[model samples]
Target: MPLNASLPRRDAPFKLGATALLLVDMQRIWLEPGLDPDHADWGPDHYFYRQTREVAIPNQQALLRAARASGVEVLHTIIQSLTEDGRDRSLDHKLTPIHIPPSLEAGLPPKRLAPVGDEILLPKTSSGVFNSTNLDYLLKNLSIEHLVVAGILTDQCVDMTVRDGADRGYLVTCVADACAAPTPERHSGALKAFGGYCWVAEAAEVVARFEALGRDAAA
Candidate 1:
């Protein structure tokens, strides 16, 4: 596939070197079962579970693989309680405290598809990664002007991050298929809300964009 201007080309808005893939809450804790001891309260039955399991996870894996192969930095983010007692969580969390186990068995990606040694791991206790973590500083330090955003809960963390990133001057590409919400309506609504704020794209198209860039470089 040839690189085209109609597509969200990293070079047109910002150099490829200034771009990165920001994967938010791709954790098994939220996408899989048995990780959280409190699964009875919020488990596979959750409305977003199937979408995250069947759609977001696989697409996220592909995007991460492609981003790494193309030499684009891959950054992961997780929303977890800072303390076992849930004392450090945000006010929203305070109102709705979460009781997840302190285990990495499902908190991170599978070992076979885990982030490479060079990938950055960012932890946050809020819906947005930028404000909760040092994401802004890190992006600025690395000169990242564009962000390819994907992950679970399209209407929450992913949505908040996209808006924040855009506000901070980063060209954001929201991977539609690589994000989910409690329902189809919520997922669609979130993307619709972000319609004017970012370049909303499908996972396949995003993958093709990266592959096209690779081909262009080879030529």
Candidate 2:
């Protein structure tokens, strides 16, 4: 994905009071090449690095800035096991053919940019953030009913989280450019699969809509 300068202006501002931004799996394990020294080495040929650098990070940064300026609560969703022994991880992580670790110390940490302000970090042991964390509780407490989602591994964690958010009745807007997958095909497929459940847009468009909301409030 490239930087989209043509941002769409909403006809009217959305209910900004009920909106929040959820950034999922934007951690070092996925974003940084050598964060996990023990993991398989990735070179310039790695699709993950190229997509993240060329597409996701920049878009995510734009969304974060816009959300902060618009006063939309910003939250991060990360995958982490509750126990060192991986007992709290999902069956897929515990089983073969898909063994995922539950610790960030070795493979995870926010990579491109650090969380500032009072942004809350929600940890989960499963693909869906809501399934393993108190994300629902936090959203309810904050009265957040609309969510703008962006992050890495668009085909996995982000997809699952979006589905969960939709099922819980939140109006979701997925920033396509701010998300990445192992391949372009997988990324596009994931977005298409969940397109019906959420309003998908580029980061620039989402940022424009958010800023438009601010303008409406000022007016």
Candidate 3:
């Protein structure tokens, strides 16, 4: 498909069992305030944190609730190194200096947004989960064909996941309000830049779709 081609929505009926809600990099390192005191500018007062705390987290919660109620599989990914010395990270991560020590609390998601029951939490050292993790195989095993993505850094991991997931033949939908970047410009720019790669919608719209799917299933 052309990069500028209009995105085509999946025509098949929405099936909860075949859809997964993937939360990307929603861990404490990004969500928690004051975790990076060294860079106080990037702390709670930053636009990223403000957006996350005021918008993304709440919207993601709604998405999570709807996904769970509709029986859509839920998965989360965090930027965590597999090795104690951080040697297992992808080359891109190493160069970008994005390393999260597994031993630290920063690797864990916030309590309210954390996975429950059998939901999967994948620790990845790369921005693209598909590039560093067995997520593709896992999704295949779960028979997932549609991926609903929400999480931090709209321009980075979330963007990469949408593009990669689309290229892998999965129908991907990005929850715009459930994602944030360092600035509003970057956040909106990413959506526009990758708009053709996947269906981009607000959390409320995605939740409504899930609810409608539930209603359809009941009928």
Candidate 4:
């Protein structure tokens, strides 16, 4: 028997109603500068900032529009602690020295990617939203089996979420062009590293797939 014999086909079509668009850690902290001036090295000239502002953000906007139009559930996750003092962060985060004050706007998504209507936003303290939040339970409750992911720091939060989601049995797809990392090499390497765990495609392909699903449902 093949290793994937028991798993759903990797190329299976997405069912719009059962699919969801999960934007991971797209908050102002990562997308915008000046939020963490201490790390001034991550300025506008940095590869991470450049890739996110020039490539990822615009592509994610396209995905967001298609998701809304196709009625795909949209969810956002941001790295945040439950308490202002940062007592609620995961051990990994604490050790990593990654701290985001609960009261700061750093946890909020950028204006262009803000949630609309009944869309949801989940706050997490760990790299993997599935590990620190009620995301898995919420997905189950919403009957979401297919998760389309897009976000920043492709080598960190996005990579963790994609791998974890796949192991938990969700049909996961990572939008390559809609995610960025500390550097171009890290971004591409993370995608290639996790390529076997989930479907990896560009933003345009994902939007097309979502649109196709909508058409099929309407037929």
Stretches of candidate 2 above 4 Å error? 1-13, 36-41, 96-108, 217-219
lDDT of 1 by residue, 7-116 (tens): 65432443566778988887766666656565547667676777877788789878877777666778888876666776777787677665433454666665534678
Q: List per-prediction Cα lDDT, in the order shown.
A: 0.78, 0.78, 0.87, 0.88
Model 1 scores worst on lDDT over the 10 consecutive residues at 5-14
Query: Can you write out model 3's per-residue Cα lDDT over 91-156, one digit (the tens) per residue?
Result: 887887777888988779999899999999999988899998999999999999989999978999
Model 4 regions lying over 4 Å from their true place: 1-7
**TM-score: which candidate is best?**
4
Residue pair clashes in candidate 4: none
Candidate 4 per-residue lDDT, tens place, 1-219, comes to 988688776557888679999999988877777676556666678777888888999999999998888888999999888899899888888898888888888778989999998899998998899999999999999998899999977888999999999999899999999999887899889999998989998898999988887787778
Top candidate (lDDT): 4
Q: What is the Å distance of residue 215 in model 4 from its true position?
A: 2.3
What's the TM for model 3?
Answer: 0.91
lDDT of 2 by residue, 42-84 (tens): 7756987898888788888888888788888889877666666
Residue 162, model 4: Cα distance from true site in angstroms: 0.8
